[model samples]
Target chain A: METVILMLGWVGVFAPVALGVIGSTIGCSRAGMSACGAMLDTESGYGKFVGISAMPSTQAVLGIVVMFTLNREINTLNAPGIFGVGILTGIALMLSAIHQGNSVASAINASKNKPEIFGLSIAPAAIVEGFAVFVFVFALVVSGAIPQ
Target chain B: MNSDQYITLMSALPSLGKTYHVDIPPISRFQLEKRLNLLTEEHQALLSDIESVLHWDHLNSHYDDSELIQSATLVLEQLTHKHYDTLREMILWRLNLRTILAGLRYRQRGDELNHQQSHWGVGDMEAHIETYWQHPYFNLQSRFHWIASVQESLQKNDTMQVERILFDVTWQYLQRCSSQHYFDFTAVVTYVLRWNLVSRWSSYDADKGVEHFQSLMAFALGEYQQLSMGIVVDQNGDSK
Candidate 1:
């Protein structure tokens, strides 16, 4: 049982980065495909489209930070707290990243046609990024409370 | 189809403004065809099947009502068997609208509802239409308010008005479907359909028509000059 808990603690410590990487991979590809396609239709503004496609990559960075914060000596006492916070934060980050990718793709598509709305169109993606940040901050705060 | 593939394919297409509002299509036919080449073979086949039933040119041929219904039924069955629920639904709705318009036309011509006509309608409302053939709007006006307007336009003998109303309704329906489907195969299909609508309306522009006519005339004159020169050369060759 102790071995199982320790294994889980290691898994939890790694989960945020793993899941966040997966999410970021999918999200970036999704938005990147859109950006590449939009480039075909437009004469200029290629830089902004490329920039939007990179928006989902932030989640991966946040996940890496969370993983580092959660990295410490594993034990039965700390395992459960780390496992719970780590896994939940990972899931939240993953979902937010994926959805943010979709939002970014939509924003790129819209603003490509109506250049005037370029700033406003990215608001949804920013909102999604905010949610991911919330998960990152709370996970950090909560991981500190885990028995060391 | 890969979701990313669809996102890319659709993003590459420029937005088609409101149907009938644009003086010309945002994208030319050549560019549209180039972009459509991005679709996978399977999706391309699926799009062709869907267009057969919904595109005006395909159905505007000299086919009778029964043949048209049969073709639509076969296509609908194929779409259903392939689990293309959205496409099947859109085609079904379009067929129903066609049936309503045909029924309205027949009634206007003073032709009594023929009992033997099983091929008249093609959707859930077909039975309702048969039962309510004597009623203007086929008793389905409450469900489809636009039917009344279509009937009124028909009465006025305003073909353009009828086409305009039908185009608007179809555009709105496509827009609704598009909302539910973003960055997917369905969205791509809806965009093509909307583009067709805009193209059709743009074709009605009198100025464009005159320009097209002038271009045709110039081409014809050029061809005639070439033919005359060829004939003169042939005569000279014979004399030699």
Candidate 2:
């Protein structure tokens, strides 16, 4: 039972980074493909499309930070807390990144034609990112309460 | 269904604005065909099936009503088997339009309603249309108000007005569907359909213009020849 708990602790510690990376990869690829497509239609503003494609990468960075914060000596006492917080945070981050990527892709598509609305188009993506930040910050706060 | 497979393709397609508002499609036929090459082989086949059923040229008038219904039924079955809900809905919409319009034309010509002729339409509304054949708008004015105007225009023998109303209604319907879908197969389909709308409209205009110009030229030339003949006849009379 002790060994199982410790193993779970390690899995939890790594889960955020692994899941976050996977999510970011999917999100970035979706948005990047859309950006590449939009580039074919427009004459200028290629830079902005490329920039929008990178929006999903922030979740990966946040995941790395959460992993480091949770990386302490794992024991039976802290295992459950770490497991719960890490897994939940990872799921939230992953979902948010995926949906944010969809928003970014839509933004890029819309703005490619009507350049005047570029800023407004990205607002939805920014809102999705905000949800991810909420999960990241709360996960860190909860991790501090776990037993050393 | 996951639309991720088509994100790039859908995004790459240029927006086709409102049919009446646009003078020409933003992309040329050659450019559009080139972009369509990005679709997968399976998707290409599916799209070809869709076009074969709905495209103006493919729906030849010479094909009797029964033949069109057979082909449309087969295509609808294929779309259903593939689980293409949007495409199926679009095709059904078109079939409904054809049924309603055919009913109107038949009624306009004072033909008796023939319920036995099931080949007139391919969908569930055939019975309803036959039942309401004597109604001015086939009793569809409550649901499709535009049918009333179309019927009125047809009665007046204003073919151009009827065409305009049909184009506008079709354009708006496709536009509404397009807005609900993005980065998906439905979006691509709607875009292509709208492109066809624009191309057809422009060509129709051009053809009408050429027809008018030819008629005007014929009248003017006829008047000139008549005057010339009269002048020669008068001159010969004076000489004699």
Candidate 3:
């Protein structure tokens, strides 16, 4: 029972990093594909696409920070709480990153054709990022309630 | 060609078409020359090909109405052919429909369908149009029911009614395609088609132009709905 609890606790601590990285990897690749396509269409706006493609990478960094914060002494009493918080938060970050990446890809595609809409087009991606931030902040807040 | 990039290119087409729209009546030779100059070098080359065939300078000076109409018809045929080679399948269908209509009209008037000048530059359709008209294999009959309807108009000898029916059929086809593939390149192609129709109708009747523009807005709404749904599927039907 002790070994099982410790294993669950460890899974909790590392879950955010693993899931976040997976999400970011997929997200960045999706956005990067669009950026590459945008570069082919226009001559001067390559920088914007490259920059937008990096948006999804933020979730991975957020995940890393959450994992570090969740790291603490593991026991049967708090293992379930830690596992629940960490796994759920990781899932949220992962899904948000994936969706945000899609939004950024669309922005890059739209702006490449009409450069005048570059700033406005980023609104959708930024809004998606806002949701990720909410999840990140809420996870940090809720993780504090779990007993060490 | 990612699906997103195709959609982006398509979304830009309406603005591009708007740039080509002219509001003035009886466009002057000077205005036409100026417009040609405004286009990119590639577009200018394409337009020059038509001008060379028409000898526009001589035609403009002579002001022969029948000759001008003939030249315009030839120019449309040439451009239609060129666009078929460059544009997507959806747009090629629209071009084919226009050619089919022109062929029907020519047949009704007992004009020589085999003449090179009368051809719309569609693949084998220019040569085998009569066979296709009579037999219409390969689902062409269902795809283009307008052919038979136009034949009825031909019997009545109502050229205006035939044109109206063709325009309606083309508009409905565009609307259907746009709604069915709202997230794909079809939506953008629909916009360009709508703009082209609006410009054509407006040149003839301002009320018709306004009506088509309203329909274009409806199609644009469908595009907006697809975007809001966030169903990002590529050309291969892979979702992100």
TM-score of chain B only, all predictions? 0.80, 0.80, 0.45
Mind giving the per-residue lDDT tens digits that candidate 1 earns over A1-148?
A: 8999999999899889989998999899989989998999999999999998999999999999999999999999999888898898888889988999999999999999999999999999999999999999999999988988
- Chain A TM-score of each model, in the order shown? 0.98, 0.98, 0.95
Which candidate number would show the highest TM-score if scored against the true structure?
A: 2
Identify the leading candidate in terms of DockQ. Answer: 1
Instruction: Tell me how many residue pairs clash in candidate 3.
Output: 0
Count of steric clashes across candidates, in order: 0, 0, 0
Order of models, best TM-score first: 2, 1, 3
TM-score per model over all chains: 0.87, 0.89, 0.49
Candidate 2 ranges with C-alpha deviation above 4 Å = B59-61, B114-118, B206-240
Query: DockQ of each candidate's interface versus the true one?
Result: 0.66, 0.61, 0.04
In candidate 1, which residue ranges exceed 4 Å CA deviation? B59-64, B205-240
Tens digit per residue, CA lDDT, model 2, B160-217: 8998898889888898898888877778878888888888776666678889777766
Shares of reference contacts reproduced by the candidates, in order, are: 0.77, 0.59, 0.00
Residue-level lDDT of model 2, residues A1-148, one tens digit each, is: 9999999998889888988988899999999989988887888899999998999989989999999999999989999988888888888888888998999999999898788999999999999999999999999898988988
